[model samples]
Target: MNLSVGITLAAIMTIACYSYLWRENTLYRIAEHLFVGLGAGYSIAMGWNNVKTNAINPLLNDGQYILIVPLLLGALLFTRFLPGSNKWLARIPMAFLVGTGIALSARAAVLAEFVQQIRATIIPLNSVNNILIVVGTIGVLAYFFFSSKFTEGIPGLKYGALVGRYVMMAAFGAAFGNGVMGRISLLISRLQFIFGSWLGLM
Candidate 1:
């Protein structure tokens, strides 16, 4: 069967990776290392390209000196690898990055998870599906209520919390099933590629 070098190499790597499913072997280890090395090299090259085009060019050509602050901070990340007490200097940039990341992520998460989810749940109870959605949402929230013991609280809340627990279990189960289905789909696609494209036996 006719096969291009790229397709042949891809097939070999695919087989090598799948070989781990049976048992770890030298071929799988080689493929894994090759994949990691190529990925890291590509990431480094892309990062440098982005800094040159996006940051360096703007700072030098367009007189955007403020970019230097971020550049300096990024460079400080590597200082952690240096010897002695000087490694503490890296924490300055690390703390700044973590603080900003947390602030940005928390703000976005509040808007998306709290506000958007509440809005979505506040739908008209015009259908059975909408009713179930509203009930399930409330039950899930009640299950997470930790201020007071459920036994000491409102009488009906204990039952509501129980229902909420069930709802959460169902949600988790569905998520897990979906994940397994996705993995199976990937396996099917790989099998099709090996048999239909490479071997021409499908």
Candidate 2:
């Protein structure tokens, strides 16, 4: 319960993983495999836990007979392990899973990535920031759609697109810098854990 052994094991694993920075070796390979195996095992455990808590417990204790339909669909997933034509039964659950996932994901993505973006850009251009946002959004769109030869003889479109290219480059650069900062922050925290907690070097 005190987790002393867990801390020691994590320290050793961390060193083994970071050893790959110098060169690959047995220690790094072992650490990699251990991490992956633990992740897979944890995922399987969580999957069963979810199924039991949400489906089985309800069906058995609460007498929720309606849960049987989804339970049957879930059970069909294991038919792939059986022999002969029964393997095709797994496809039904797989198709349902894939179709449902895509539908939900696409709906969320349209709201987050498309609708929200357009809504965010619709602010009044009374301020400099708002003006820049409106101009930048239009420029970026023009850069993509107006670069074709059909856009010839269109005055100012080319200039707007050129501005858009720079705007896109700046956006990408900022995103990349943010990602790098996140990685660097993780490294710093890991180092702090190693030196401060593991070595008591504070």
- Estimated TM-score per prediction? 0.87, 0.83
Give all candidate RMSDs, comma-separated: 2.2, 3.2
Cα lDDT tens digits for candidate 2, 1-202: 2248877788889999989999999999999999999999999999999999999999999999999999999999999999888899999999999999999999899989989989999999799999999999899888877446425766778888888999999999999999999999988998888887877777
Cα lDDT of candidate 2 equals 0.90
Query: Number of clashes in every candidate structure?
Result: 0, 0
**Worst 10-residue lDDT window, candidate 2:** 146-155
Candidate 2 wrongly placed segments (more than 4 Å): 1-3, 80-88, 98-115, 146-155
**Which residue pairs collide in model 2, if any?**
none
Candidate with best TM-score: 1
Off by over 4 Å in 1: 61-63, 103-110
71-112: candidate 1 lDDT, tens digit per residue: 999899999999888998899999999999999999899989
User: What C-alpha lDDT, on a 0 to 100 scale, does residue 54 get in candidate 1?
Assistant: 85
Q: lDDT at 34 for candidate 2?
A: 94
